[model samples]
Target: MPELPEVEIVKLNLEQALEPGDEVENIEFLSSKLRTQLCLPKDIRWPLSINKLERRSKYILLHFSGGFLLSHLGMTGSWRVEKKIKAQKHDHVIIRWKKGNFWIYNDPRRFGVFEFGVNTLTNKWLAKLGPEPLDKDFDTAAFLQSLKSSQRSIKVLLMDAKVIVGVGNIYACEALFRAKINPFVKARGLSSKKLELLLSSVKDILQTAIKKGGSTIDSFKNVSGEKGAYQKQHLVYGREGEKCVICSQVIRRKVQVGRSTFWCPRCQK
Candidate 1:
């Protein structure tokens, strides 16, 4: 699945190619269903001009003059801007712009979504999401307060969308490793100093990953159909059984909350 950095990259690329006045000339849904959501093809108003593009958590929001287009790229899903070409087998949704450009949504697992509505921010998907980790509002004080009452594992807390959006498994492991904090520590057990370090590490890791176009662990790709390069810079993720770059100890992997977690036993305490 595409996480925050990946979704943000898609938004940036789409914004660069799309203008405020570029209208959606037509929409074609090659698949019968988009994940669990059902969007009637005729419900989409033709010639709908795009107003802006925004990303919250892992969801992409395409602001239109009348309403909004919400997209969630589930596992193995991606959005690409391409010229007229033969559509692939998994090309689920295609939106033709008036400028002759085509925005194609491809998902091999058929888990992506295409939802349309007005006042979308109040919807169930976006209503309860926590503060964007990259936003200025996600300060150390606020983050600490959010974790003050949680006894969950620090790594689990960090992955919670209600605590901080977009800190997926890979980034969570990398951030904890960079902060020299064990993923198994209780969230409330962290000291103020350690919380500060953890928060800073999270921000740094996420910003750096966004700059690198996110980590492509499996099938993640940018809007240009290119793989992300941040995976090569990972500190601990996917490096299990390998030597730790910092402490020379073997990087260990464990399953936490059913997600794989990587860390250096000697370096991360």
Candidate 2:
């Protein structure tokens, strides 16, 4: 899955590839949208010039000269930029620009979304997300305030989109491990100091993952078809029963909210 950092890279890559003055040569919609999805016309002519690329959480927003294109990679999807290549099976959406052809949205699982509208950047889909983990606004005080009334497990609380925007399953496990906090601890039971550690670890792990091109356990890559290099640096996620990298304890895994949670019993409380 493309987390916050991966989305950031995609935004940047799109921004650079589709330069500011580059106008849309043509737009095509591969699949039809159901009437119940509230989806507008999938195939339409869009007169748009690339303005700027912005990212919120895992969502990518392309601010055009007249409108916006919102895309969510969901899982098993990517926006690959290539000079030349044959379209693969999952290449659902494609955008042709002046500079080159950019393979926009490709998702084998088919959960990715591609929508176009005029100034719909602040739609309800993005407005509900919480503070981004790496942004300056995501302070320890703010984090604690968000969790002030929560009795859910710390892992579950962190995963809440209302609490923090983009800490996905992999980063959550790594962050909890780094903070030495048990994933099963109640959110309201954590002390201020522990919360501070958690906040810091969240930022640190996200930044590190972004720097490493984000995790690609299955099929994540940049718009350039390169696999992310972060998977090799994983410490605990998917390392169940292996010795913990920090305390030499066996890294344990359990299901919380239907997602696997990995932590070291000896290192994390």
Candidate 3:
């Protein structure tokens, strides 16, 4: 699944492709399970231009003249700009412009979603999310306060969407490993110094991943249809049993909150 960086990139890509000045020629679903159940039927009506392309948490918000289109790029999902073409097998949703052609929202797993609602509900999906890790508001003090307020394990705490948005399992493991903190450590057990390192690591990892266009594990492609280069930069997420990049200690894997977490037992104390 695409995390914050990937989602933000998608928003930027979508905005560049479908700005307010552009006119929507059409909106259709090639194959959607929620054709009617999830989103309002493809109401390709006139006078509907994207007023803003925003992202809240991991959800992409497309504010339009009439309503909003919300998309969640679930696992194995991607949205990219392309010249309008015939619908492919898994092209769940297609949005066309008056001139440049179309954009495709393709998802093989069909786990991705497209929902429609009024602009007033933008907060609905973003409301419960915690501060963005890359935001200036997510400083050491704030992170410590948030973690001290919860007793969840550090790994689970990192995974909490209400604590911080977009730190998925992959990034969580990478961040924790980078910070040299044990994923199994209790949240409240972190010292101020360790907490500061953890917070800094989170920001650094996320920003670096974004700069690299996000990690492309599978079925992930940037708007240009190029796979992300960050996967090659990974240190621990999927390197179980491999030598740690820092200490040469063998990396280990464990289940935390039902998600795989990789770390170096020697380096990550």
**Number of the top TM-score candidate:** 1
lDDT of all the models against the reference? 0.86, 0.79, 0.79
Model 1 ranges with Cα > 4 A deviation: 41-44
* lDDT of the structure predicted as candidate 3: 0.79
Q: Which 10 consecutive positions of candidate 2 have the poorest summed lDDT? A: 33-42
* Poorly placed runs, candidate 2 (over 4 Å): 33-45, 83-85, 118-122
Worst 10 residues of 1 by lDDT: 36-45
Taking the tens digit of each residue's C-alpha lDDT, what string does model 2 give over 51-150?
A: 7788888878877665677788877878877667577877767777776755556778877778765645467677678887777755667779878688
Better of 1 and 2 by lDDT: 1
Give the candidate number with the greatest lDDT: 1
Can you give the lDDT of residue 131 in candidate 3? 77
Clashing pairs in 1: none
Task: Report the Cα RMSD per candidate.
Answer: 1.5, 2.5, 2.3
- For model 3, residues 1-269, the per-residue Cα lDDT tens digits are 78888888877777777744787676776654732344444554664577788787788888877777788888877887877575556778877787776888888787777877775434466656777787765555776898988878898998898888888888889889888899998889888888788878888888898898888887678777777778888899889888988899999988876789899999888
Displacement of the residue 74 alpha carbon in candidate 2, Å: 1.6
lDDT of 2: 0.79
Q: lDDT value for candidate 1?
A: 0.86
TM-score of 3: 0.91
